[model samples]
Target chain A: MDNSVKLYLPTDAAHIQTLKPNTVVQIYGTLYTARDQAHKRIAQALKNGESLPFDLHTAAIYYCGPTPAPRGKAIGSCGPTTSGRMDAYTPLLIEHGLRVMIGKGVRNAQTVESIRSHGAVYLTAIGGAAALYQSRVTACELIAYPDLGCEAVCKLTVENFPAVVSVV
Target chain B: MKIVDSNKIRSDVAKLITECLITPDRAVTNALRRIDTDSELEAAAAALIVENNDIAERERAYCCQDTGQAVFFVKLGDGVQCVGLRDALDDAVRQAYAAARKSVADPLTRLNTRDNTPAVIETELVSGDTLEITYLAKGAGSENMSKLYMLTPADGVDGIVRSVVDAVERGGRNACPPLVVGVGIGGVTETACTLSKRALLRPVGVLNERADVAQLEKLLLAKINALGIGVAALGGRVTALAVNIEVAPTHIGMLPVAVNLQCHSLRHGTVKY
Candidate 1:
């Protein structure tokens, strides 16, 4: 097994740049969960010059819509959604100081370029490995967009959440 | 005639939803075991995927968060009597999803139905007294990558080969690699798409019966894997585990081709009564 890097959230741009593709990382810290609907709302807010629900600078956003927890669990089978679907809204977030993005699948060319230019990195949690991944999410709380249900923005405290650096 | 209860169908459907989500089909597991990893990245991905399956099985949790749209293909015999079959199945889906706390998002409204009801059920009347129900929990990621094309006969099998390869290449990592490519050839537009999805119900690594069709499947599989999309589209040699093709007679002038990509999770099952 390759040695894994332990990364704390709100990572610095220099720290992100030091990481390379295929570097196995165990992430520890707060990750904001957002998917299609939440992204749209955030992008729309930015368009309207309104403040976002959460801080964007140096923050990591996980693209996921978790299942409802079943008794005693913090979250249920919370895995990454396809990152491509959020491609349209990603570049703008990166421009606004988002430093890390986590999801599965390849991002579009523009998003990749934004990550490169804006000093952000893209990581992929193993797609379909929700059950295993959920074990790492120590706590979860709904933060915004309660009406969106599963697609709502939530804050997750992760402990050694496994992922691979896909883009840097 | 064997009399099966509608309640049985409902319960079985519910069981299938849970079972398929938690444990992968045997063929898919076998294929995953056989994946050839060219890099540590691929190896790590394969390990995580395998471990995820085990965790899902041990914990009675879903292998994927999506848990997917409840899609069922039911084949019923003329002699079998289940008066409220449709309602029973719907009820079963609702109860099962509720028990699991799974999400079944409404397509138009994008709201969680919370119970995963109103399954996309496709039924056919068959000759025997047995009822067979095949369940597929199709995640949106790969489903969004599906495509249908209306081609001139001039395009031929080569055209299909090109289209399938191009779709996989274009899809890249989005649909999830180590995919199962289902190709539907020769039917009309919607029928071709349905046939493509139905073709995915076949076990992984199984080929079409016709010699020519099987050859086409083999060709398409090779080309897709050759694209180097890798596991989870991360960049590896094992892009696709299998390619299954289904063909139907079509009008002489028009040929429609549909492609449905199933991610490595490949949550599918069939129950017969």
Candidate 2:
């Protein structure tokens, strides 16, 4: 019982409510990563029309702030952070061409409307499966906001990255 | 004289706390392993979260660098009377947090905030002259989702399962998984919740001795995992790593069940004196 939906960017808000509870989907291609602090930066960037570190078109943004990497590991416990915190920034990101949004928990009404309007979907990752999520990440490079500690922007490469397109 | 220099014991307790935070417990370890073999919905949810560990560690490093919330559950023997126990324990927490900040490389944790603060100190009087302490450092994600339902005797077992499943489904990905579903059945509503939290102290996969209660655990596990709320609610087969049921006989008319959700980063330790 799996269905596919389009990806939402960091600020996209549509299709959040339509997401039936428990729908599974596989995530493909590149996406931006951000959590509470990073979202604020992304939102501020939007307000000023400043170029983001990564292109927003067709990008899927996952809300997460992972643990530090061990000696040789790419990342640690890189699971989805809460989605509710990102609701405020979603609509704006969707407007900018973010297709798929990856996170956990329910989205607010505005976010759901934006997802439906923008043709973007929301996906959830296990909240605390850090070691497991460590496996899917192929590579990671710091993109911006190194000062924010774990909350910094980092570009991650994922392969066979399995995610359920939670929205219809 | 003094009851075994409770200060020294507190220091030792602090050391244990430090160790527990840096390591993973059996419950959390099992939860991670279960995600691997979970069903499709469960797997996907777990897989992504397993991926999120990197971020969690980073957050752990940056936030609450002090790791200051060092509270303990102490059981003092009837033969002993430790003066300044509370003040000493508080000093240990403060000292440990200070040491953690100076020596520990990780970031400061969020302490003294809503749902995160006032480190819980539960003390019980027991036999002997020694003191036993249990250290629990609960994180926010899972703790936020914990709930207690006051059920009537009529609600029975079915009611317990429904309430728990509903909590899990509604909790979604916020609680973090595969969660240790601690079902505290019986006692008053608040005590039921405490029982549930205490149940979490049991090792992963351990079942209650009572046949009927054990059966209820199995049924509830099946229903919850079936909710397809799999890992991080990302969807998976193993929604909860293990359901631990701890029950005490309740009032004739009341059947209270408290569901305490412990996140995948279950950091807790116990010490017996």
Candidate 3:
């Protein structure tokens, strides 16, 4: 298993290394953020044939709704929420050429199956390492759905953004 | 008739809530200490921890927006009868919620009905001159995954371990990982369940009175981590932060064990008056 890769947006899972169930990996790079509300909006946009605020192809999505940033910081302690909540929407994202997902919790059978079929990797983040994570986000900006508060879709620029890739 | 100061109770509860908001709890803080290497699990945990803190800070929110079913374990002191202890406690919760709501969002969703109640009170009268209240805000995720089992003597420790571990496994990614597992042993059926929940009140990494039980906690901790449940079950080595067991003497034929878990967003505060 490759020890590391720079995670990014718009990347296709099929193009990356073959991902088996429960393989571990370290991810570092820019990743798009989303959670319950944000995922719904993205899917809705896809359904309408409308261009999403950000491209899904070749992208990595972190399932999260981050709090506002501290003074002079890029972001607050941002942690991944539970992944099971997004199980229904993940396969669709995978179909759109999404390559990696960073979050916590187990995925539905179909979600894991989609990863295997699509060559996608799922990364596990420590569920409560909020403040420590904020240190890695070198840059951040709201890209869409600003009204969603913490759930608003945003773009995060990270460096050596550590994550364990588990294929389970 | 003994009289207790109701206002003191309100003040104490409010103070506890505020302090809890400002600082990340020990469970999260300790877990941060373990993220030494750049594994997928640590990175995932690091990434999510930032978000958790951000919500706690920027959102001006509770450490977990699921302020939870605020369950308070209150100990009433002897000779000190507090007028409206329950009402005053509830009022304190209400006030704290109002004071802190701007920063922390409520945990309710269109899918949920409990919405915004802060603390559920479990009062016990003890011999003392001061009131002691332990506030545990049971977050929605892990609380939902908590389980209770009535095992025959045959189920044994292995069975208990399996039940607890299986709960975490079946809970999968739902109960946020690096979970603080509270295992209650020996009590009768329902008492076992209550013990498990109360066991969560024990600080992370705290051990049992019995060396055997403490060893069991360590054993369970190792096995659960081996599950590769990782943070949020994305998969990794650190599926649980710690395993804490609280045991009681049980009926001759019963080996009841209850397992309750606190997710990464474990939040509890204490107040003494």
Q: Give the top-scoring candidate (lDDT).
A: 1
lDDT tens readout by residue for model 2, B22-111: 554744554664545535655544444443443344444222121324446777788876676777666655554542322212235521
Score every model by TM-score: 0.96, 0.68, 0.73
Candidate order by decreasing TM-score: 1, 3, 2
lDDT of 3 by residue, A1-168 (tens): 235554444445444664444444445567888988788888777778888887776567888766556567787557667777888788887787676788866677889899878777787765555555666688888989876666778788876565665663
Comparing 1 and 3 by DockQ, which wins? 1
Q: What is the C-alpha RMSD of each candidate to the true structure, in Å?
A: 1.6, 6.9, 5.4
Tell me the deviation in Å of residue B64 in model 1: 0.6
Predicted candidate 1 versus true structure: per-residue lDDT over A1-168, tens digit per residue:
347889898779778878978888999999999999999999999999999989999568999988888799999998899999899999999888888999998888999999998878999888888998898899999989998878889999998788989889
Q: State model 2's lDDT.
A: 0.66
> What is the TM-score of candidate 3?
0.73
Candidate 2 runs further than 4 Å off: A1-62, A65-79, A92-100, A105-110, A121-123, A130-168, B27-71, B82-117, B249-253
DockQ of 3: 0.23
Q: DockQ, per-model, please?
A: 0.74, 0.23, 0.23
Report the candidate with higher DockQ, 1 versus 2.
1
Model 2 TM-score (2 dp)? 0.68
